[model samples]
Target: MALTTDTLRIGINKITDQVDPMGAHLNELDGRLGDGDLGVTMVNGFKNIAAVSDDLPDDFGMACMDCAKAMTKVSGSSFGTLMGISLMAVAKQTKGQTEIEWDRLPDLLQAALDAMIARGGASIGDKTMLDSLTAVIAATTGKTSAQDALAAAAEAADGALIEFFDQPCKIGRARIFGDKTKGMDDPGMVAIKSMIDCFT
Candidate 1:
């Protein structure tokens, strides 16, 4: 039902250290279209996690709650709000568990996907972090290990980005680039995919 506290901590750390780099990737890819602050925002958001990492809930459900609160508190960006709400969804599903059953991870991830969709109002193939995250989730769902799953996710994210280039943005500033975004790949997708690549 929940992962160990240690895994949760690592997840938080991974977000902090990788979020910026991922943001950097997105900024480079879509900076001309957007505010170019995805990296800075994610970096700052994750940085704050380290300070309160010790306060992470002992169980997975509680941990999710804590994570959402922390992200909302630390980040003032669109992505942060989405991430926070996503975690809140996960927390809701995993309400009181100590270790997540590997088999249930897919459900957890799917729940998160639903949360983001509901909050951000972005559909699949939007070239946003959701695209990347969804791709990874699809690939990792039935895989045996986080490493293998993440590897699949990264590759999937890359492919998803390609698909996104053909569609005009429906939600954010990236919409301006529409046709010109043809080969650029969404920055958010790249960043999220890269982070999964590292963990995988």
Candidate 2:
């Protein structure tokens, strides 16, 4: 599907529906690691975004940016804020464009990565959302095929998550896992990657 405002809204909407379920799952796993609130946090962010869909801009990037601002205002959680930032970042890259072309998706994804990095401070393998996002970005950094790109994005996220097996957790609830987390992948990262897969 073309990345129009309505299409983007549908994308976020579908993902929004999954947010609570995904968040709950992530939180359950987090309880095994840290605060166990990551799921709740994500759900709250998406919930807020869902509430504002009626006001979304017609342009894809503008819509994303608008939603980002709305999420930032509506959400009180860290994950919520981060989501808004990433959305806005993608939107930022498309500010000058008349439309959201498939050709620009790579840059948009990278912009989200940049935003995530600048705002979240998570690294390449921090057992954070970055792992999934990084994998997606790296896989289709400049490739075409919005569908393939989205697919590659999800696949990369899964692959990046595998690193958690032996890699150390520097951020998120997994950081508290210590030894227990060694065998488990970061649930939030997994969900983020999984959720992104839906758009394809």
By TM-score, who's the top model here?
A: 1
TM-score, one value per model: 0.87, 0.86
Tell me how candidate 2 scores on lDDT: 0.72
TM-score of 1: 0.87
Tens digit of lDDT per residue, candidate 2, span 10-114?
A: 877888866776777877876776667667777776777778888876766777877887677643347667787888887777665545656667677778878
At residue 189, give the lDDT of candidate 1: 72
Q: Give the Cα RMSD of candidate 1.
A: 2.3
Candidate 1 ranges beyond 4 A from true positions = none
Per-residue lDDT of candidate 1, residues 1-200 (tens digit): 23576787987777666666566766565566688777666777677666678888777788878777777775445877887888899899877877776656667888998988887888886667787677767777787665665577768877787777676665688777678766666766766666666575
